[model samples]
Target: MPIVMDVDALMEFLRREFPQVSEDFVIEEVTEELTTVRLAVGERHLRPGGTVSGPTMFALADVGIYLAILARLGPVALAVTTNCSIDFLRKPASGRDLVSKTRILKLGRVLVVGDVLIYSEGDDRPVARASLTYSIPPRA
Candidate 1:
């Protein structure tokens, strides 16, 4: 499917719809097949061990897939996650941003399925993986 929203449009949508965490996320790249997003790590995203927290990584994956869906479907704020499974494969590097690459596995009329792989900035190994299903809201 072609992308209806590019990186700039996605970033604008995030800032308009979700101002609270919009600044933390950067829509790095958006293509027909994949979308890449970056999370600007801050002190709040770190655990006691000075590594990125699981919840933080999950948030990146979630947002990454969400943006990927929106890129193909346009600004569907009502589209919401129906299912999510995440695995923390390895500990994220300290004092670095997190990057997620997301691609849609299936794009149906009612549901969208996708997966995201997250890596610490400058690292080759993925720190986490997530599979997500989103329910697209019915159009009136």
Candidate 2:
């Protein structure tokens, strides 16, 4: 399906709706088949072991999937995550950002499903993989 909201429009909507973490995420690319987002990792994102925290990675995955859905379905701010599963494969680099590549597997009228792969910036190996399901609100 064609994209209803482009990256610029999505970014603006996110910035206005989620001001807390909007700065941390940057929409790198958005296309009909895939969307890439970068997370600006800083000292605050690290855990005691000097690696990125699980919650941080999860947030990236969630946002990636949300953006992917919004790109196709337009600005649906009420759409919410109904389920998510994440597997941490490797430790993330503390000095680099995290990149998420997301693809929508299914986009139904009421539900959206997607998977995301996260890589440490500058590293080719994946640090995490996640699957997400979101509930799309009914149209008014």
Best by TM-score: 1
lDDT of 1 by residue, 1-140 (tens): 99999899999999999999999999999999889999999999998889898889989999999999999989999999999999999998888999999999999999999999999999989999999999999977
Instruction: Give the distance in Å from residue 79's predicted Cα in candidate 2 to where it truly belongs.
Output: 0.6
Q: What is the TM-score of each candidate against the true structure?
A: 0.98, 0.97
Q: Candidate 1 lDDT (Cα, whole model)? A: 0.95
The candidate 2 region of ten consecutive residues with least summed lDDT is 1-10
| Per-residue lDDT of 96 in model 1 | 90
Question: All candidates: CA RMSD in angstroms?
Answer: 0.6, 0.8
**C-alpha lDDT values of all predictions:** 0.95, 0.94
Per-residue C-alpha lDDT of model 2 across residues 13-123, encoded as one tens digit per residue: 889999999999999999999999999999999999889999999999999999999899888899999999999999997789999999999999999999999999899
